[model samples]
Target: MRVEMEFLGSGTSSGIPTIGCDCRVCHSANPRNKRLRSSILFRVGEGEDERRLLVDVTPDVRMQALRANLSSVHGVLITHTHADHCHGLDDLRGLYWGGGRERLQLFAYPESLAQLRRAFGYLFDEDYDYKGIARFDTHVFEHEPFVVAGVAVTPIPVVHGNMRVAGFRVGDCAYITDTNEVPDTSIAKLKGVRLLILDALRRAPHPTHLSLGKALHIAQQVGVERVFFTHINHDLEHDQINAELPAWARLGHDMLRVAIEADGRISTDEGGGGVAPLAF
Candidate 1:
């Protein structure tokens, strides 16, 4: 079995080319510099029988889906409930109506789930009786492993400043974001990961997000075969930051796709809009 992953968006909360900024990276001619809020799509199985799993429904998810040609999503794995990460829940209604009529499965930590319910009360309100609302079969899990769509998913717990968030490990690949601290236990869980998609906010240190140095340390500690940094801010230009990284690591961009083989080998096919594949 192979798991194909796509970087639907790879920008920080503010996104690249941020509003009212005249920085070099924002004005760079490179298409890779243009980004949306962080999100990823995981495709398992093959051909018409494939199952699409989304990680983080950002406010840009609707546009992300359209850009990626995503027709339907079978499940969603939420890292946290931050406005940038989960505010696009309402957009799932279009997928429900146009593609899969069945309810989508949503996996999240208890804290994230609580926050989501609070933020989107109308969706969870059975008595509201509103039609055309997005629906999900919510499943709450802790820092444990669970199965979704026949794939084993292990939730790695990490600290995002004062709050706890989840990083998911499925097969040979792991996707982690919005985290500053990866405890020893979580590090142990990430051991031997073949492909790692991690949060690398910027060059400077942050209270709630991992800096480029911290992200590289974690990637080296885990000994991942290939690593891509996500949740990037405008401070780092795609080409400039990638030039500083080791051959095994690079800055991820929107629409970059990675193929994870069953034998733990990984290959990348960058989005064809002139962005090269981050060296494996």
Candidate 2:
């Protein structure tokens, strides 16, 4: 299956510029320097049958979609309940209503769904309606595999200290975010993937997120043909990191497009895909 994976956001939870800090990456002239929190969009099939699966609806989700010229969606797969990952979900209400209203399918673990319900009370509350628009369905995920719009998805469970988050293995492309360490069980779940997009929050150690070194170790251990680091911070400069990385590994930037062919061949291009940044 040919799938188009778009990086909606590649920045950390704080994002670039980080609200007043004067960092070089935050002030760089390169468009890739402007990033939102980590999120992605998976477009499968073509034409009318095309299915859009959102990895995480970050706070910048609306602008990200707007930047990429995406207006409709099929479902959402949340990694965790972090605000940066799920706050932008409210914007999806517009997608539910074009001429009329229609509910969309939402996939996540019980806890993540609970977080969504708690965070966005209006969507879950039947009594509340925003200009005659509101609807959604929740599919609780266990450790088992499932399908969303005909694409088989395997959930990989990783640890963020005491908490557990579900990373996804969609086709040959596996995406794991906000992870500090991947236990043996999670590693088993991630193995044999051709393209792995794992979290690398920064160069220094973080309490909850993986540093660049740890991320690289996990990528090497997974033994995937190619690896791309995401959830980046301003501490890791794009040019500096890319220059030191092995040919197979890359520091993912905003608007990066990763195409996985039916034969599991992985091809990615940030400059040639005509993919514009979702925001400035």
The top-ranked prediction according to lDDT is: 1
lDDT on C-alpha atoms for all candidate structures: 0.86, 0.82
Model 2 collision count: 0
- What global local distance difference test value does model 2 have? 0.82
Estimate, for each residue in 1-280, the C-alpha lDDT of model 2 and write its tens digit: 7777788889899887588878888888776677788998887776787788889888887778777777677778988998888888878766666314657778998999998898888888877745654588789898999998788889999887678888988777788999888998888887788788889988898888899888989998888888888899888888788999888888887788887876667778855753353444
Off by over 4 Å in 1: 271-280
Q: What TM-score, to 2 decimals, does candidate 1 have?
A: 0.94
Runs in model 2 deviating more than 4 A are: 98-100, 274-279
How well does model 1 score by local distance difference test? 0.86
What is candidate 2's TM-score against the reference? 0.94
lDDT (Cα, tens digit) per residue for candidate 1, span 1-280: 7887789888999888788889998887887988789989888778876878899999988788877878788888999988889999999887777555778789998878988899999988878887888777899999679988887889999999989989988777889999999999999999978899999999999999999999999999999988999999999898778888899998999888887866656879754542523211
